[model samples]
Target: MKGYFQKKKMIEEIDKRIIRELQGDIPLEKSPFAVIAGRIGISEEELLKRAKSYLDKGYMRKFGAILLHREAGFKANGMGVWDVPAGDVQRVGEIMASFSEVSHCYERPSFADWPYNLFTMIHSESEDGCHEIAERISRATGIKRYKLLFSTKEFKKTSMEYF
Candidate 1:
């Protein structure tokens, strides 16, 4: 029940601070790293090196935006869960991720009620597009059982500040 990123190398206090600073809007400046480095009491080169090292050592996933789907012209942010067999999870995940609309894909533990082990996010321009993605994924993976949980209400959305 643990995660993969627990054992990371060269992750220090400064690196944690750097991650915290990047959680929100990146400062608008000539040298973002330089500004961030100054605030975190580290050299820009050191900050950049640690960040790159984290990526190289698989400590951090791709760092980017937490976009507002509706504002970004994506009318639906559907959570597509699939009952991909254990042996086929990797291939099926890759196939799902290959779709133009799928934003993310990963494996998760399955429950009795929720037999889905593979999960993916499909942000589409419309509900029809999301359905199309679901249909294509079903055909591609040959897994007939899956569910598309679309967001009916904007309840809570925010970025987690990793400090």
Candidate 2:
């Protein structure tokens, strides 16, 4: 713990220790930062600064809640797939990407049975809402042969801690 007093850069040992604490799920309490700080033998501010630095440096992606889509009253989320021609793929993908309801959009390898090359996820509070979004995109893009695969049943939606 000599480095604790020195304000030096994080060495391998300290870095490993910090990683160990982070790998485990943080204690549940009114003041979680205090719990973590106490366990790490550091001030809450220092721990927060280190965490913020990690987030700022892109070492940590987004830190937020991952709620179950079903519990949140989202009845259906459709994968709106499009078979846009190569010339309009980029344009249509960009347009599809602009919708706030569309959480993710990507290009996937097409199959003989499923000819869709591009896919956009439309998550909505209701099935009708999701369908509306899909229909709107279909009308906007002028692509008729798209598929809407909704969530039939959630087999798995669990959150795990990464240490």
Using TM-score as the measure, the top candidate is 1
1-163 per-residue lDDT for model 2 (tens digits): 4533235554455545565676556667789888887888889888888778767866566555556777888767898888888788888998899988898999888877878899998999888898889888888878888888887877976455433
Q: Model 1, 130: alpha-carbon shift in Å?
A: 0.3
Clash pairs, model 2 backbone: 23-163
State each model's C-alpha RMSD to the native. 2.8, 6.8
> Global CA lDDT of candidate 1, please?
0.81
For candidate 1, which ten residues in a row score worst on lDDT? 1-10
CA lDDT, every model vs. true structure: 0.81, 0.78
Poorest stretch of ten by lDDT in candidate 2:
2-11
Per-residue lDDT over 27-69 for candidate 1, one digit per residue giving the tens place of the 0 to 100 score = 7778888988888888889888887877886667766666776
